[model samples]
Target: MNEHYDPGQRRLPSQDFLSEPARSIPIRYRPDVLVVGGGPAGIAAATAAARSGASVLICERNGYLGGALTMVTLGSICGLYAVSPEHITPVVRGIGAEIAERLHTYGGTSGPMRWLETASLPYDPNSFKLVADDLTAESGVELAFHCSAVAVTREDARVTGVIFEGVDGRWACMASSIIDCTGDGTVAALAGAGFEHDVPNGQAPTTMFRFGGVDVERARQISRPELHACLERAVASGLSLPRTAGGAFSNQPHSMHLNITRILRDGVPPNTLDTRELSAAEVEGRRQLRAYLQAFREFVPGYEGCFIADIGASIGVRESRRVMGDYRLTLDDVLHEGRFEDAIACSAWPVEEHGAGRGTRWVFLAPGTYYQIPLRTMLPEGIEGLLVAGRCASASHDAHASMRVAGVCFAMGEAAGVVAAQAASSGTSVRNVDFASVRADLLRRGAFLGEDRLTQPV
Candidate 1:
């Protein structure tokens, strides 16, 4: 049989042939760091890593960055700083605080400290996305949007690359070291690192929704009514609160972000999230959020014209997995104000717990005290070439509440970025990093030190 090729049939139009030129341009995006997630932590990590002269790449799933802050409109950043005699202090310096200061300049964040969250600030989500983009770009970090890291590649228990799902289907890029900033330890899970989801009884998870047309000033002047009280009034008015209906308020004039559901999932399953379960949680969570908003208008003060502005397209999960790091930070570590030469961030936000079918709890530190989060907590146990940041970092379920805040997450991410870059350049394992050098770098980047520095200036 003779096989003949038709030249006419094989010929392509210029439109098609243009891209397939004889000498095709090589599509190469080699980054020194591959930071996963686009939230505060991921941004900090990518920025720090790239700023250190390492080619860096940030992969984010959504078109917009800022993670929970942009998605859920989180109220305040926890663990940015702390003040106390045994203060433990915030050792995290560098790009993390720089971003915070910059955000403040843009009106999304308030100017620095003031007794924990006294100066809690808010900004338009779209604006934040721009700020994040400029930040990573300015640091010379390449960014990939609409990208999700679904898998991690390892060799002999060492991380080498992140397997991603993006516009180009499945592909991966090599990295000397990786930072697991995915809040749920998605990368760590793929890396075979150990973790524990909300312990004992599953903890409550929330799908954040926004309420617009709110009288923010009026609401701020006095207690417009906390979520619990608002629900209580609803009950009095014959409305019942969903078992999962609970959340902290956000900064939108009329918007309140709710953490109103406990998504039930098999922790042992290959996936931590399921569309069906997540949808159910969102539906139920929104129902409760609307009910409370109605109650606020009818029974509470300063909620007139307030209505559900938007519900998070994506669920804002609080806990799923905690990477088992070399040091397991415990509740006692927080209560004792533990400090370490490898300190990464500081916190004063108390042990907060949101029970799924039960209720909510906030355990605060003494009036002026704070705690230190050691660096060992970020090192995944038995996993070389991997660093965990954000909520997944090493911490007891309860300790996570304090460290999981956005401000703290940023510092942690930055630390991880620095560590990863250092490891890549020096040809050393993450464990071999010099803390003094890290500290020096952080300070140079303008990170506020000492717990009192976190205090609100009168």
Candidate 2:
């Protein structure tokens, strides 16, 4: 089956449209589970499903894996640990822990580092790509790189397959169960599933970059407050900087990965789904890097000799479309440490919101406490044979600010994979899969869904 578009039929005086003749897309390899987006979530989903005795295929739009981690050059894996003044506790385990351990072996990461009421694992983006490749390959998950999911094949309300456009043109691949790990809810949206998109009011995006020739010792000594003060000085000196306080990490000597530039246009974040606006955002993000470099050189200590080592291939979009699911995770849930009977993942990450303002808003959870994410959050409402995971999972904006990080995504993906595999193998609806069995499988796989599950027998 082929989905067709005919925008040319609508005439507009200001625009010209052309329609290409419809053609059938070739059916590619069939798999029990198809995971889209190849990011943290897709990696775990495909790996778990394949290891769970189901044939799985993961399609990534980029040439490599590690979506935002590699492509956007994210310096660290957030949401893995809960932190307080006295101790840092691991809250995300299972595939997330496994990946962290693997990164350690590859010298890709320096393990968890505590900062301003939180803890994260600092990693090298390049090494992460290799780790993702080896992890998925060893798990027997087929990989198709440079493929973008363009359309969905649906039967009633169920997603039967996805059509992807790659370098070789379009092709379709059938799957018994599908997981939308696209981060933007692209797959679910294409399948006609309802979603919420509010870019102007959503969390602002960033363009991460790296600087070389930095005085690592001096830079490391600067506290978050000091850093902000320095940037503020730069701003007062007739320089423009959208954000004063942000993250800066060094996994390599004399180099720093900076996540500081907040991309906005006309006092609001540009709609990233629009090609022109997205392109402009990318350019603006890079443009801000120069101002940042000057600010660090003139106002901040230890960056006088710093030079741009790299800029992300694209801007890091923090939020886009949050697909409506069986449950919408709320800020109250995050703050109160909400628990669910069918919990599949746990997150301690705070509600870190980036807006049009120069400073971000952070509402931290109780020290060492985390909230459980139910399986229902991944089950898109009115959709069958599909699961939505990762940043695009059903969550209120404030709640998404907590769960959208890489660690929680890994946990969510792992559960979605296992559930999808079970449903695919049994020829059952995803919602019909027994929660107890799913929880048991997740536990058996060494996942931590919360302390409440510890008393239950696996």
Candidate 3:
């Protein structure tokens, strides 16, 4: 009997199928550090590694850098400055502050916008991309745009290299150390790093929109309570509004960036890895955006003659897969303003949770205080030659909300890159790198931790 033929005599198809023989993948670059995802975190990582005299390679799925900052037009660098009504010192500095200063020099950023509890620096997306490119180039890091990290090459408990797919072909690049800055924790999860998934009641995804010809002064003058009342009236008047209390900020003259659209898919958590669910979320997010435009035109004062300048390239994802690392930052740590003996970064941003409700749920830290992001948060368990940064760093859902902002990501990425480069050059594991040494390096670079700062060895 033919193997392709059924015993009952039913017609059968040919059994032969094309398969490739085993072959070696051409090594594109052998760098001291390989950073995945050229967003804020990856850019910081690559730049830091290269500046540390290590050859670095950074890849991004998109054609440009500044992942959410550019692609999603996030506009603001939250958690960069401190969060006190008085004495707003900058909690985030070093490379993060350098980037912000560049943006300000280019007239692409606004001065510190102070709120009652926290403050942030708003910047232009185009300026962010250019600044990222210039900084990364100046650091002598090799950048591969429009390439995706599809797979990994690992040897017993260690990731050796990353396989990337591009328009040209597939190639593998070797590196002594790897940093997972894919925000969604894509690379770490693929490399068998354990992660927390599908967080219950996680923050919802948001779509940011730009409006042109708006009366910026008038829009800024509208208080939060007044805006919420308008949104409530719009919903009551049968507007297809998804949320009730988002607001707009002035990005440029006569232009306002609105972050008012919320998207929630039934049976699908906001941070789901399902492609179908993500697609639906995108579509519905855009739909909600159109409705928001209509509502603003009909209900708001300054938006009567406004028009949408642009929508984000993608929906802004808030919470996602957080790799389970050496330590999981908890909500208690954030609320109590926990201080770590091995603190690598600090965040003053409150826990801003956008959930299935009319508005956001905000939990505040004590005035003029912040919590420490320990070095252990970036060291994922059961994965060697790898470190997690950005929003994917180990944190409980609420803690993630507080520390997942761009400023904290930049600090963490720089720390990861510096440590990874050191470990690579010194023939050591990332986990073996001394936290006290890391603290000294960060302090020397002008990063703010607390008064009990680490001092160099005598």
Candidate 4:
């Protein structure tokens, strides 16, 4: 009945099983604010909180920073500028603008380009990662990689600390405030926060791929309609094409980034948190990429001799868990350009909803206008010491469609970080902080919260 049984043993009695008594995990570090998920929102939150005189710690599961921007190889950073045919207005400022400025300084970004009606700033993913690392380090934020938040430690209504699993082992880190920026709202969900799921079908998840040896100049010569027409012809010729009107952009000489493949997770919901299904989706995405390579080589003119230079480190998941916060942003708010008294961020990106298969629909607001994202959307209802940012913020599906872009995420994160720092330093709950003071600090930092004075001239 020894517990040290043979490894090749077929069976062992339950009483003979080895077990360890529950013990307290070693505390690795204690910070005023602990930001989980090192994507755009987490980076912004950690940097801003640290700059606000709070000791901050940011944990990321990825080896590098820049969340979706770098991991998914998302081609562009959208939602920074207001959408209008007459002129473009940059509304997302503060840390978002700073990141873009850094990218521009490195010649890593392309000027504003209109896509699906809204304007987006495309940048080199490598440049974004470099800038994110520099800013996070410079802000005096402690960084840990290959670490994932697994569970929440709470006292009554407030989250006291977070338990994470990493290569070293399970450990706990205490913090006065926690920011959930895992895109999928991992931290908030673990803290018993209510959330929504897409159920039958979520917004289509795409696996971005890039092509090398492409004739970028020649590809630019063809109109989008003409290119889609070519794709239609390819589909008619028995090419297994998932989407026909998907587009690609030239990022470098002879290099093009394409966001075309659509992986339908039919049986498995996008937000199920099932590792097996996620792995299957990734495999299917790669398979689809190969099929696209064949079609590109045969049908497209510029891609005749091109080859896939890279594929995304992970698939681009559009919708996941939308945490139920104090305020749920609705479509009417976006379409009518609704303003809020406690507005923390502004977005002008239209509601770009992608369905399961081929088509995507767009709905725009009035010209030279945008809607405000209230601070309540980031404050999960009934959850203290927790703030939700990025795609997981409280919003209706349609409203999320517009505000889930990178630039908007940056704004939200900055606001959440400042709020967290204020609450942590004051030893008060996030709900008890004075929002007017937060606004004043944001304005000083160049964040455009739909304020006329802060809005940059086009």
TM-score of each: 0.83, 0.95, 0.93, 0.93
Predicted structure with the largest TM-score when compared to the true one: 2
Q: Provide the overall lDDT of each model, using Cα atoms, as 2-decimal numbers.
A: 0.68, 0.90, 0.83, 0.86
Number of clashing pairs per prediction, in order: 8, 0, 0, 0
**What range of 10 consecutive residues in model 1 has the weakest lDDT sum?**
1-10
lDDT computed for candidate 2? 0.90
- The residue pairs found clashing in candidate 3 are none
Kindly report which residue stretches of model 1 are placed more than 4 angstroms away from their true locations once superposed. 1-29, 83-93, 110-119, 224-230, 243-272, 357-359, 448-458
Clashing pairs in 1: 32-55, 82-451, 114-456, 115-456, 211-255, 214-254, 244-260, 247-259
Give the per-residue Cα lDDT of candidate 3 at 230.
86
Model 2: worst 10 consecutive residues (lDDT sum)? 1-10
Query: What would the per-residue lDDT of candidate 4 be over residues 309-352, giving only the tens digit for each residue?
Result: 98989988888888999999999999997889999999988898
lDDT of 3 by residue, 141-240 (tens): 9889888887889998898899999877899988989999999887787788888765446778888889998988888878877888888899999997
**Model 2, residue pairs in steric clash:** none
Among the numbered candidates, top lDDT falls to 2
Candidate 2 lDDT over 222-251, as tens digits, reads 998999999998999999999999999999
Query: Counting only residues 3 or more apart in sequence or on different chains, how many pairs clash (N, Cα, C under 3 Å) in candidate 4?
Result: 0
Root-mean-square deviation of candidate 1: 10.0
Error of 2 at 154 (Å): 0.6
lDDT of 1 by residue, 169-269 (tens): 76776777778787878788778888876333445566666667766666555442364565576777786554323434555445654444444434211
Q: Could you tell me which residue pairs clash in candidate 4? A: none
Off by over 4 Å in 3: 1-23, 267-272, 452-458
